[model samples]
Target chain A: MSHIIKPILYSYWRSSCSWRVRIALNLKEIPYDIKPVSLIKSGGEQHSNEFRDINPMEQVPAMHIDGVTLVESLSIMYYLEETRPQRPLLPPDFIKRAKVREICEVIASGIQPLQNLTVLIHVGEEKKNEWAKHWINRGFRAVEKLLSSSAGKYCVGDEITLADCCLIPQVFNARRFHVDLRPFPIILRIDRELENHPCFRSAHPSNQPDCPPEAIK
Target chain B: MSHIIKPILYSYWRSSCSWRVRIALNLKEIPYDIKPVSLIKSGGEQHSNEFRDINPMEQVPAMHIDGVTLVESLSIMYYLEETRPQRPLLPPDFIKRAKVREICEVIASGIQPLQNLTVLIHVGEEKKNEWAKHWINRGFRAVEKLLSSSAGKYCVGDEITLADCCLIPQVFNARRFHVDLRPFPIILRIDRELENHPCFRSAHPSNQPDCPPEAIK
Candidate 1:
């Protein structure tokens, strides 16, 4: 029931949010096409009128699937889970489900928004980078505390829930910003484990259709 | 079982995130104690070593319950739901639960973090207010679109899920920033409706123990 019309994702290679959706789609084994919204060059293509038609907020990582357009990377991922529940991204139990949401919320809500490129641009380049590092470190420290109790092989119990999917991309961004992750050994350990997984590996920035040659590193 | 021991919430009146937890506690009819962590004066009391011992992040809105100390407002809320499942803040079905989570995620992950006072401060005073308004508008717009389809009496399925608990504080922040919410009729409608409700009304910043009288309005 899931394989009919191909999905189209408006994305950018270096975008952590877009990277999250890409990973979710790949993990679900859902086929999709990519439409790159270059963040650099020409003052951000996402602000263009054509892109705004797809997403009023003019953000990257908007998804068009089954004649429906969904923005917000988390929403797109959830929509995919709803439309394609075969390979579930969430847990089965109510408590576990809430826990997964909590973990994702910590990264998605509590951390990512504080450190995104757009927010950094508004804050000024030097302070923006510092803000990103400060919040990312704060978030990672909290995640380390959480993982200390909750992690086994992945972020939740043993399985890879949406929490891990959200974590990797955020940690990727934190590393790119030169935020030292040494204080978050548990988080770093879980990230190391997931980085090698086929689903996560396939969704790496280098693997994205529009990734630049220099971005592969 | 519910009346055994009242929850203890370490919070501040003007903190929008703290307001969120306060509303959730009130809505659940969970009686609790409030320990104020003033964000201003005394150079932001949350930075004290004493408070930092309670929450490593030194953030307000931490909850201590059943011998567990929980940081992160969303995590604390979820913890309450787990500990007291009688009046569920989540949906009954997996799909519905995911949908509720999607709404919460949009505001929590997409909007709230961007406009947080701490983040604004990092951006500095010159552009701080502008930064707050920009992210608030961006988040509210996405919320408006998402709520337009799902709302009946609330953000999803006419029930007061965690989404509403999240929505009220965000709307309050938006109004505080003068985001011109007229464009978001659905959000405004729900905001108006919730604003009058006892749970939201009582949790207003003005009503909090720490909020100054002059700052209440």
Candidate 2:
């Protein structure tokens, strides 16, 4: 194989989607640089023509690798799993792989989008927290129930699969919104375990270069 | 191969995610039964203990196939692709496959979730259409831009990939919410082309057994 340039990830410090990709990169032990695109700075730099050229979606977690740009966190993870092929993020068994993707979709499609910054802005400041908590609680119920059946030490079985990558960030968002976590003991437990893991620890929002001083503990 | 029973899909007639799986099943030529779980009937049969037992997520497009159940449309599609592997939904080339998934995530995660029935319900009666249209338009712009580079006769290329399956249902939703398609000629064109394709036609919401009389043309 030809020598490939190190990937560059265009990410936002607090973006859950970006954080998922960050964890995947670390787990794969891929050397990459973060070119932070502040989502909150100057009313969102993602909307600029420059970033739009990189990802027409103007979304964070867009990655430039292997001479092409990739957008969407789950899609980027899939690319990494295929290209890197080390520290595999998805299980080999078809059913287990499907289960991993199932957990991912539950968070990627079902949970995160509804409570994202865009949606919250539209939800308005008056009812934002209530709206965020409502959706987060509804989604976490599904995640907890899913984890009950599939989880072991991580989200699916004892292996730290892509499901773990998706789960941790959303759990962070749930806490950020002040959604009660008591109902999701499995999720809470898995999150606690993952928080201590080096990959997850390094990828956390508070550790990102763009993380504000106030956000650090 | 061992003798396999036909899959049973727990789906709602007009649910876009369910429709995406329906199209994939048709494309694969897989014989299946639809056990319609009405989303609106009696406060949603999907929320019942019976349905919850099948899918803890309490969402439709759950499939009981190959002695295991699968939830999430994209996950089920991945299962179908891996297990069946007849008429392939994803391309063999890695980058092309990533592109297909990028489009899928654009709809599944970015667009469809924000405008889903649950979100609209929370957005409330008065502001529902406005909210739905707002999200659909934002997501559509991103999709249209992506399609500008990827689309040929279909979403990703000339072939009807998984991206097409995700695209058609979303275009239907965009129409449902009265999102202006004038700015998204590529998306509109692809939707028009796919609407008449046999696989897309048979799997359409209007063609579903559970479709109501008023929904039919």
**B140-194: candidate 1 lDDT, tens digit per residue:** 7777877776688988887888999989888888888888988889988888888
* Standalone chain B TM-score for every prediction: 0.95, 0.98
Best candidate, lDDT-wise? 2
* Model 2 lDDT per residue over A1-217, tens place: 4226889999999999999999999999999999999888898999899999998877798998888888999999998998889989898899899999999999999989888887788778999999889888888888888878889889889899999999999999999989989988999999889898999999999999999999998
Regions of candidate 1 where Cα sits further than 4 Å from its true position: A1-8, A30-33, A65-67, A78-99, B1-3, B78-100, B213-217
lDDT of 2 by residue, B1-217 (tens): 4226889999898999999999999999999999999999998898899999888778888999888889999999989999899999998888889999999999999998888887777778999999889888888999999998888889888889999999999988888888889999999899889889999999988899999999898
For candidate 1, what is the TM-score?
0.84
What share of the reference contacts is kept in model 2?
0.84
Q: Would you list the C-alpha lDDT of every candidate in the order shown?
A: 0.80, 0.90
Using Cα atoms, each model's DockQ against the true complex is: 0.38, 0.85
Model 2: which docking level applies? Answer: high
What is the lDDT, from 0 to 100, of the residue B45 in candidate 1?
Answer: 81
Best by TM-score: 2
Model 2, stretches more than 4 Å misplaced? A1-3, B1-3
